[model samples]
Target: MKQSEIIKRLSDKELKKQVFLSQGLLLIVGVGLSFIFFDTFADWNSIMGWKPKQILFYGVIPGLGIVLLDIFIMRIFPEKHYDDGGINKRIFKNQSIGFIFVLSSLVAISEELLFRGVLQSVFGYLIASILFAVVHFRYFTKPVLLLSIFSISFLIGYLFEVTNNLYVTIAFHFTVDFVLGLIIRFKL
Candidate 1:
C-alpha cells in the first residue's frame, strides 16, 4: 500500500484513540514486567555521569539536537510528517500546559521503561532497540521513518548504557515528545 493511504487510515480518530489507549497500557505492562521478572530498579539510578553538565551533554543536547534535525527533515519533506503513529492531533491541541506535561511524561516514562529499561536489560541494547523500532509499526509504511526510529532507539540505548540511568533516556524521550507534542498542539 502507498504511504499516503496508510497514513490516511491511521489519522482517523478511532485509530488515534487506540494508540493512546495502548500507550496507557504500556506503563502498566512495563511496571508489571519489572516487578514480576526483574529484581531491581537499582541500576536504573546507576548514573556514571552524575554531574549536571554531563546529563545536559549526554541527554538534553542530543535530545534537542535530534528533535531539531527531525524538524528540518520534516520541513524539507513535508509529507514525511504524516507518520504520527496515531497521536490524536485534536487532543494534543486541546491540552493545556499542565495536562500536556502529564501526557508527555506518561509517554516518555512508559516507552522508556519498557524498551530501554526492561527489554534492554533482557535482550541487550541492539536487540531491544530493534524491538523498540518494530513496536513503532506505523513507521514501517515509510521506510525512512522506520529507519529514523530505529536509529533514534539505538542512540537512546547507547545513552542508557553510558549513563546507566533510566532517567537520561526518559529525559531524551521526554524532550522529543514534549517539544513535538507542544508544536503539534499549537501548529495544527
Candidate 2:
C-alpha cells in the first residue's frame, strides 16, 4: 500500500492514539534508560540542569527562531516539499487549543528525553542526531523534509551538548511543536 493510502485510512482519533502510545513508550524507555545508565537518580537529576532562565534563553528563543524560519520556508517553497502526507494537519486541525498544547508537550518531552537526554548522553551527538532524523521515517522520501529534520535534530542535539540541560532542549522542542501545531490548527 502507498503511504498516502495508509494515511487516508487513519482517522484523527487513531492517529492521536498512535501518537500517545508511541510517545508514552518513548517516555518509558527514556526514563528506564536513564535509570540504567546513571549511577543514581541524582546523576539523572544533575544532567537535567533545570533552570528557568536557561530554558527561556537557550530553548524558547531558539525554538521560536526555528519555527519562524520554517514558516518562511513553507511560504517560499512549494507545498509538496514540506508535505508529510497531511499527518500533522489531520492530527491537529480538528483539535482544541488545549489538546494541541498537551499533545505537543507530550511529543517534545518524550522525544527529547529519549533522544537528547538518553541517547545523546550515552552515545554522542552525531549518532543521536542521525537516529533522530532516521526515526522520522515519513520524511525519508522527501529530500527537503529529510534534510530539515536532520538539521533540526542536529541543532537540538548541539543545544543539549552545549547547555548540558535536558530542560532547555525540552523547552525548545515544545516551543517549536506548539507554535507550529497552532499554525496547523488555525490553518494559518
Candidate 3:
C-alpha cells in the first residue's frame, strides 16, 4: 500500500490526539527507563557548554518560533473544535500554565539527555536523530510532517555535535515549549 494511503487510514483528529497522548506516554516511559537502568542523568557540564547567554538566545528564541508557528498554521487552516468527547478539553484544562512549564521543561531537558546526550554521543547523531523523529511520528500527519521533525531533530543534534553542548539544543527546545505554553495560556 502507498504511504499516503496508510496515512489516510487514520482520521486526522484521531491521529493528532493519539499522537499527542502517545508522545506523552512515551516520554514518561523513557524517563522511567532512564532512571531505572541507565544512570542517564549526568552532570550538565559534561553534556552542555557552560554559557549563560546561550540560554536566552537558543532556548528562548526557537521556543517562541514554535509557538508562533502553531498560531500561524492554525490561522491558516483553522481547525474546528473536533473533540472526541470531553477528553481533549479536559486535557487542555488540566494542562494550563503550570502544566505547560513543567512538562515543557521536563521534555526539553529529558529529550536532550536521551536523544542528544545518550543516543547521539553513544551511537551516532544520524541514528539517534532518526530514532527521535520516529518516536514523534504520531505528532504529525503528512510525510512532510515527518520530514520537518526529522530535519529539526537532526539540526538540533547537529548543533550538539558541532558545539559539544547539549545546552544549545536544550535551550532551543525549552524556549520553544515555554513560549508555546504562554501562547496557549493567553489563548493567543
Candidate 4:
C-alpha cells in the first residue's frame, strides 16, 4: 500500500499511541546514551545548565521567529507542499489544549535530549543536525518540508552549541512544537 493509504488506515488513537511510544523510546535512548558518554554527573550537568535568560533568549525568541516564518510560508505556499500524510493534523486537531502541551513538551524534551544533548555533544553540530533532519524521514519526499526541518535542526543545534545548554534547545523545541500544535488543534 502507498504511504498515504497506510496513514489513512490508521486511527487517530493509534497514531497518538505510536507517537507516545516513539517518544518514550527516544527518552530512554537519550538518557542511556548520556550515561554511557558522560564520565560523571558533573559533565552532564555542565551541558544541561539551567538559566532563565538563556531559555528566553536562545530558545523562546528564536522559536517564535521560526513559527512566524512558518506561518508566512503556509500562507503563501500551497498546502500540498507542507503535507506529512496528514499525521500532524490527525495527531493534534482534536486534542485538548492540555494534551497538546503535554505532547509537545514530551517531544521537545526527548528529541532535544537525544539530538542535541547526546549526538551533538559527541559528534558535533553538522552531524547532529543532519541526523536530526534525517530522523524525520517522512519529510524526505517533500522538499520544502525537508528543507524547513533541516534548517530548524541546524538552528536548534547551533543554539545548543552557543549556549552549551540542553535546556536552551529544549525550550526552543518546546516553543515551536507547542505553538504549532496549538495552531493545528485550533485549525488556525
- Computed on alpha carbons, the lDDT of every model, listed in order, comes to 0.76, 0.91, 0.64, 0.92
Model 4 weakest lDDT span, ten residues long: 1-10
Q: Write the per-residue lDDT of candidate 2 for residues 70-134, one digit (tens) a residue.
A: 99989998999999988998889968999989998999999999999899999999999999998
Candidate 4 is scored at a TM of 0.97
lDDT (Cα) of model 2: 0.91
78 Cα displacement, candidate 3 (Å): 4.8
Instruction: Give the range where candidate 3 is weakest over 10 consecutive residues by summed lDDT.
Output: 81-90
Error of 1 at 26 (Å): 1.3
Per-residue alpha-carbon lDDT of model 3 for 1-188, expressed as tens digits? 84445546766456446546655765676556556545535644566667777656665566577657656655765353211232323333435577667666777777877787667876789998998888765435544455557777887887787667878888888776677556555666
Best-fitting candidate, scored by lDDT: 4
Give all TM-scores, in the order shown. 0.81, 0.96, 0.65, 0.97
Per-structure clash totals for the candidates: 0, 0, 4, 0
Q: How accurate is candidate 3 locally (lDDT)?
A: 0.64
* Candidate 3 TM-score to native: 0.65
Considering every candidate listed, which one attains the maximal TM-score?
A: 4
Clashing pairs in 1: none
